[model samples]
Target: MNSLRLAAGAGPSGRALIELREVWKTYRMGKVEVHALRGVSLAVAEHEFLAVMGPSGSGKSTLMHLMGCLDLPTRGTILFDGADISSLKGSELAEIRGRQIGFVFQTFNLVHTLTALENVELPMIFQGAPRASRRARAVELLERVGLSDRLQHRPNELSGGEQQRVAIARALANDPKIVLCDEPTGNLDSAAGMRVLESLRDLNEEGRTVILVTHDAEAAGYARRRVQMRDGRMVEAAEEALR
Candidate 1:
């Protein structure tokens, strides 16, 4: 693996956009409780590309869910843009997620019949974005992610990499401040995976906060920083990121 910083540091802009303080997540699984996250604290700066690594049983997905506002932590504070979000209700959290965050999932999650342009425009349609503006923005994002030629193509008409790129374009439809991706390239072959990574790297370089969750070191290499987790706790490595 490359010598990526294993902690938070500077970015395209010197501002911290996401902060997790003493974050904890507990799951109630029958009589036994599961500690999915164990008091983890970290800062992800604006426009930074961060990779999270852990084994299957590790709390990587749990952390990503909390970070993406898909789930609330059982204990601790999550501050997005300097506001505490761990206490927000589901609706409030949804609004925050819709307005400020973008998600790229392992599954492309595209509507089978929707064209790439329509799939990308769904977010805005839900958010009540103006028709003209949403259409223009979706096209722009598709182009930005190198999908201009495929805008009118449906997911079934595209390749795996193209599908993921369309998903990315859709995620960016709201012009989100940060993008949270989960095993984004895990479904593709090596060549396709490389294309997806390059797309993510390009997005990060162009000033979008990019965070990826993956078990693959090769995938993590695309990030400027990597965070390792194990058994619900962050296994601190020697300091690589400048404190």
Candidate 2:
């Protein structure tokens, strides 16, 4: 396998929170093999905000999924905090993901029936946190994301941006050390998108390692370091890649 390594050295000086060494992800579809990632290697430092920018089908989302432990690579090594987790079972991966990583997506994946506060508290509830502590943390996270007034609102009752903010708050429910956001602002207007991006930046500032996968240049600009990807491989620079 050809190796494409991008050393993420420009961010905050600290141990790498996640590392992907010569990772490959392949899928089988009706006897045809699709290689989503091609021996890509990367390291994300603790508290760094790194953006992976590419157009559609560039394997950015696949990369994010592997980093987030949502899926395992077909080949190569993945390490979380210096421990190899690439070969872990699904339940073991879920345990680490729940405790240490959070995810935000293009579509706000909030439950329609759950109030904002309730949604934010859901992760903690699953983690078996006490009800009182979960509620308090939910309130604090909602307030932090400037959604204090919308705690009682359901998804249908809030704006797209508000819903996204709620998703962000919910991602923080377990106080995850790493936040993986995939096209977080894809569904909102400029103003609302800016707010969501600002919230992400604030999280990074507060010592959370944030990895954002986006095709928008403006969104990628919020990150401390940017890496461009193309055709399932990391590239150095291409102005048109984000277009």
Candidate 3:
């Protein structure tokens, strides 16, 4: 609702929309260490649709969490619009993440009792946006995702596809620079999954950077490019995006 300011020319050579330079995520379980990600570097251009594919325990989700700013790398730097995120702490990182990024989880993380409109408005409300604007933006995003008629329906009142749509709408409510989705269509039927993929593709065409993580090949096919990971390392899908 705040007039989505999707970044343009997202890359280092131009102006990286998102950059992870030599990223690593190592977690220690007592004396044993678990390395989820290892020295991964990636750059995504503005509006690029990238599908992150990997088997379970392959660190796709960990990498996604780092990109979403939900977690920090143990030994690397992630830059969002040229800002070094690894240097920020607690409240600072939270503010930037809330203001700049949107996340869509595999599970439809919607309030069961709240109306679709209310659920969609949650992020804007968190961002300290006015109540009226939150309502208006939520409505606009629901419409964008073809859920205009279901605005008054609660999560249980909607189908799985519909609930995911609301979740997607909520992700876009704040007009974030990047929309990060983890297994967005994993819980939907094939037809419903297709519908969701279409919506994501449409959003990407509308100039929003979409970074989706999926293990399904059919799901990843919707993206413009695909990046595969194995043993916590990138498999060299293609050249880094520039400009």
Candidate 4:
């Protein structure tokens, strides 16, 4: 856990890449209503590695989804690079997500039928990138995540760690500046999870802003700062140097 560095006294970078202000999200499950977030405010600076830790049903995933542009806040504002995006329609948000943000999930979410390379190239394909260029970038990203040797393997053929590596590579396919991960290592063994965490740390060190949502302290150890959530609200924050 010593690898975790805290960004103490690090004020806002004059420009936060993501800013959430009094954001609240509510879900309707039949006649029941679920308040997933409660007046949560946060600011994520450029190239910062932040971990949001909370128990199940603590709204960690909802917060991640809001930051990733997968979902908008039910109330309040979300600003991306200072522009309000809280009310953007699905297509507009999708555009922002495709070009500006990347995502990794606990499930790895790889196309079981696609090879690692193809899975990594899917984002570029959606952006209409040239085939040759997409292939080269996908290869480069896979190698960056230490998955060069697994290029042709399908998700089913790879180990949990390998699949997660491929997912990381895919997240970088669009060259996004921000990466949002939700319980990324939740499904892996200790050794495998370490690999995933190291890969994420490398990405953060390379200037990509990474937001990790997880309940595991060991996994959160890879981050420089931590925000603890409880009952849909951020209750604690800390930053410490990695020494």
Evaluate model 4: give its lDDT.
0.87
Ten contiguous residues with the weakest lDDT in model 2: 1-10
Better of 1 and 4 by TM-score: 4
lDDT of 4 by residue, 1-243 (tens): 111122222323545788887888999999999999988888888988999999999999999999998888889888987789966777888888888998999999999989999999999998999999999999999988888898999999999989988998899889899999999999999999998898889888888999999999989989988889898888888665552
Q: How well does candidate 1 score on lDDT at residue 220?
A: 86
Q: What is the lDDT of residue 223 in candidate 3?
A: 83
Model 1 TM-score is 0.89
| TM per candidate | 0.89, 0.93, 0.90, 0.93
- Model 2 residue 186 lDDT score: 98
Clash pairs detected, candidate 2: none
Ranking by lDDT: 2, 4, 1, 3
| Candidate 4 local Cα displacement, residue 88, angstroms | 2.4
Runs in model 4 lying further than 4 Å from the true structure: 1-12, 241-243
lDDT by residue for model 2 (8-38), tens: 4423566788888888899999999999998
Across 206-243, the per-residue lDDT of candidate 3 in tens digits comes to 88889999999889888877788887888746324431
**Model 2 global lDDT (CA atoms, 0 to 1):** 0.87
Candidate 4 colliding pairs: 6-240
True-structure Cα RMSD, model 4: 4.1
Q: Root-mean-square deviation of each candidate, in angstroms?
A: 3.8, 3.2, 6.0, 4.1
Which 10 consecutive residues of model 1 have the lowest summed lDDT?
Answer: 1-10
Score residue 7 of candidate 2 by CA lDDT.
47
Best by lDDT: 2
